[model samples]
Target: MTRPIRFGHQARPTPDDDLDGVARRAEAAGFDVFLIADHVGHGPAPMVALAAAASVTTTIRLGTYVLNADMRNPVQLAWEATTLDQLSNGRFELGLGAGHTPQEWAATGIEFTSARARKAALAERIEIIGRLLDGDSVSVDGAYHRLVDASVPRSHQSRLPILVGGNGAALLGHAGSHADIIGLQGLGRTLADGHEHSVRWTTDHLDAQLGQVRAGAGERIADIEVNVLVQVVDITADAERSLAQVAEMIDDGTTTTDLARIPYVLIGTVDEIAEKVLHCRDHWGITYFAVRALDDFAPVIDRVRQLE
Candidate 1:
């Protein structure tokens, strides 16, 4: 399906930044969604923070950029999702991922399992969470989770949107088959620190990933919306110069042309970046974009809308 272009801002609230004001500003700046990340080290709890954001904003949607599915049991997560959805007047978008960041588990004393194991667990969690949120009495005997007569309060939206995010063919394929939205970060293997990833920004890699999504979606392809998390949004006349440092940091032998082509990095003036936005939708079927900061991406939102 041809979807309308949408913009979302991820709020990384520090001690000095006011969360409510940040959300309000995101709405005023024309963001379609205001998102928070789920992390133990930083930021407020996503559900609680989004509830607070809901109280202040009337239009902007609230979402978890993604919650770590490994840490959350499906039943409790579904209940929290339902409450947040109701409180937000049905604006909640549930974003889930196979947990990355081994340190998160280490800090919490949760066993940090293998990536393959985590992905398998996430798939099961998604199944349970969806069934529960749909007001079904779910009973499952799975390897990672077991539930008997499990159900949650139905969300206000009847069918709340679920966004599945992360990198991996298995996970993305499953997301394609099941999720309302598939989030692509164009990332590869997690690096040594556990937080960063090897850049998989090349078209070849992305094509393979989308092929997986397409294969999984099959006839349901038209119903799913693809979202990209843009790592860098530089509104500048000198695109190459602006991206030079980023290129150095990448260290993946990716060329300047590759950088220009990658949807994960937007480095140009508002008009130029807006053109790229349309191109992404036309070429890759990606209609939704989320960036880290509101100010960096707000101008492109207006420009993209105007161009659209």
Candidate 2:
């Protein structure tokens, strides 16, 4: 357990199994956390689904992969996060984001604005949520939302981890300003550089991003956590075959591999995935990784348990 790799599964909107079953199996399979992919127009509510996960798994931390800040109410989110943290024995990590996805906004009839505006709104919302979590009466006025002495002064946990999800230069500021952990997105498998015999710089950019997150983090930066979610498992038998399978998935729209042009979807055997991830820990200085398990990734999950 020297590496302390934590595993989590994507709670698909239309999962094959019941929520309880999915949560139980994930915990039984040695996953340390369970997270849902959050989207408003097309997907289920991440927190609501996580409630079921919390009911079933006692030890595993429960939270969202990344909840869109634009679509969520800070008041409700503050309550939900604290209540779940208590229910799960104080193991909840909140992942918030600046909203994107025009298709989703169109579906919901919500006006989508420039990225800069969204970032500002997200920053304000995080500050509000943090204050409420810390037992303070919050009053604020912003371009998006306003609160006057808004209070949710009760909380079950003293502290809950809030994560900002995105890699845009605009977001690094908020990650530094408010987030306890910053999530780097990993998907769309069109990584043309790493599979070949080139010295990978994916590790290099990750190091730089995490460094920025650390430097930008002012007071809370002291013990900030860095997590990257990578789709690191594929169905094929060998390394060559798995990489090819991942290449095809990139073509088929099942995986995304753009962490500075490195395949975040590390496609290979358990040993291969471990070796690939070690680069993140050793080279990039990123220690916490949340893996998105695919259908063919059962073997990798089994292999991760062996490491444990």
Candidate 3:
């Protein structure tokens, strides 16, 4: 199904950045959504920061780029989600991920389980959280969590969107089955640093990920909105130079051509980048694109919208 093209700005705010002003700026910049990351050492708490953003902005939607499921209990997460939804006047999208950073778990004193275990727990949380957001009394005796007649306050929207993000086959498939949005970053295994990730931006990898999504989505494939987190956005005059730099940084045998073709990296002139956005939507059915910088990406929004 064809969905409206949406541009989200993921704020990587430091202590000096004015939270309220950032939200207002994103809204003024014509972004569809303003999102923050959920990490122990990085930005402020996702829900709290979003609440602050929601208070100052009138139209732009507020969301977590993704909350680490391993760090949160399903019930408490659901409660916070509902509160944010009401406070935002129904403009909340809960983006979740199977936690990947080992340092985050260690810092918080939360056990960092195996990747398989974390994915399993995340699936269970998604089920529980989605049901609770819909105002259903959930009673589940699962491996990760157990709830008896647990329900949260109803959300302001009849159906608050749940966006599940990851690059793994299992996570993508589960998200396809249960989530309203599936966020793809074209990322693979976490590196030794625990913060960085190996790249999975090749055509073969992307096809495999989409195949998994389709496999799990089945008849519901058309109902899901696919989103890609643009890791790099460079509107450069010298495309070859920029592409080579990006490819070297990725260090995954990704060629300049691959970088140019992939939706996760935008490197070209304004018009060229704008065409890539259209190409992504047409070729992959990807209508939602989120980037890290607002000013850098602001120019492409109107261009892509007009092209669409």
Considering summed lDDT, which 10 consecutive residues are worst modelled in model 1? 292-301
The true-versus-predicted C-alpha distance at residue 112 of model 3, in Å, is: 1.0
Q: List the candidate 2 regions with Cα displacement exceeding 4 Å.
A: 1-3, 41-43, 186-201, 218-222, 235-237, 244-263, 294-308
Can you write out model 2's per-residue Cα lDDT over 84-104, one digit (the tens) per residue?
777777878788887666666
Return the lDDT, model 1, position 214: 89
TM-score of each: 0.98, 0.81, 0.98
- Write the residue-wise lDDT of candidate 1 on 7-77 in tens digits: 88988997567999999999999999999998887878888999999999999999998999899889999
**How many clashes does each candidate structure show, in the order listed?**
0, 7, 0
lDDT (10s digit) by residue, model 3, range 218-256: 999999999999999889899999999988987868898
Q: Candidate 2: which pairs clash?
A: 187-256, 188-255, 188-256, 188-257, 189-255, 189-256, 189-257
Model 1 ranges off by over 4 Å: none
Q: Model 2: how far is 166 from its true place, Å?
A: 0.7
Which segments of model 3 are wrong by more than 4 Å? none
- State residue 291's C-alpha deviation in candidate 3, in Å: 0.3
